[model samples]
Target: MENQVTQLLKAMVKPDYTACSYAFMQDGKIVCADAIGVIDKINNQPITTDCTFNVCSISKIYCTVCVMQLVDEGLIQLEDKVA
Candidate 1:
């Protein structure tokens, strides 16, 4: 499975794609983690699993989870406006 994933990632990076970092977890423990390609095209710095990316949509999921947790704790109501 890991080899297949690595091969797939290698195939992906061959085109216009810049880089990728992925991790699979089971029971809160990471089963596999992989990173590929350069961090910057100019300098050709390699990226690692620890490197941060500006993942835009993922923040929405995190915000939703936080709001749901607040609702569960009776700290906020669903009808409340967030501003």
Candidate 2:
């Protein structure tokens, strides 16, 4: 799973300024985690798990989709409080 994640991230990497990181959790634990590309072009530094991204509005899209999926599956209600 870790190898697959690394390969996927490598394929997703683009341009000189872009990097991709992915982490998959199962049974309340991370099963695969990876970082690819460089965050700093000047120093040729590699991206790490510690790196923070200014995701802008991208997270909103993901959250909305996930919530809607749960709603459609009857797993959650829109008015339900997140406990």
Candidate 3:
């Protein structure tokens, strides 16, 4: 299963699609966080695990964490919204 996912990622790369990152989650734990491709064209090289990538949509994870904390404290109803 993991190998197939990796192969699929490698197959998806393109000149324009220079970088990619993925995280595997299990039981709410991040088991794998990896990336591939180049950071800068001037120093063209594949991205490494240590490289920082902009986690754009992933900013919602913090929101989720905050919501979970609210739930834990019994401070929010399931349908509550911040306004």
Candidate 4:
């Protein structure tokens, strides 16, 4: 199952999707970590496991964590009006 996913990712490489990273975590630990693509466009480098990808959007779970943190700090009330 894991190898199939890895192979599929490798076969789907493109200039637009030049950088991609995948982490398979199970029971709170990463079981498999794989990355493919370019490290830098200027040098036309290939992306490797060590290369970092930028995550631009906040996921729903991340938003929930931020809300919980704000609640813990008493910065906002649950019933407070959102701006």
Best by the lDDT measure: 1
Model 3: lDDT equals: 0.78
What is candidate 2's TM-score against the reference?
A: 0.69
1-83 per-residue lDDT for model 4 (tens digits): 66877788889977777777788899999888887778788898877777765665657778889998999999987888888
Clashing pairs in 4: 37-47
The residue-level lDDT of candidate 2 at 33 comes to 81
Compute the lDDT for candidate 1: 0.88
Tell me the TM-score of each prediction against the true structure. Answer: 0.67, 0.69, 0.58, 0.61
lDDT of each: 0.88, 0.86, 0.78, 0.80
Candidate ranking (lDDT, best to worst): 1, 2, 4, 3
Give the C-alpha miss distance for residue 44 in model 2, angstroms: 0.9
Candidate 3: residue 35 lDDT (0-100): 74
What tens-digit string does per-residue lDDT give for candidate 2 at 1-83? 78977987787787754688888899999887879999888888889977999988999999999999999999999999988
Native RMSD of candidate 4 (Å): 4.9
Q: In candidate 4, which residue ranges exceed 4 Å CA deviation?
A: 58-83
- CA shift at 56, candidate 4, in angstroms? 1.5
In candidate 3, which residue pairs clash? none
**Which scores higher on TM-score, 1 or 2?**
2
The 10 consecutive residues of candidate 4 with the worst lDDT sum are 51-60
Best by TM-score: 2
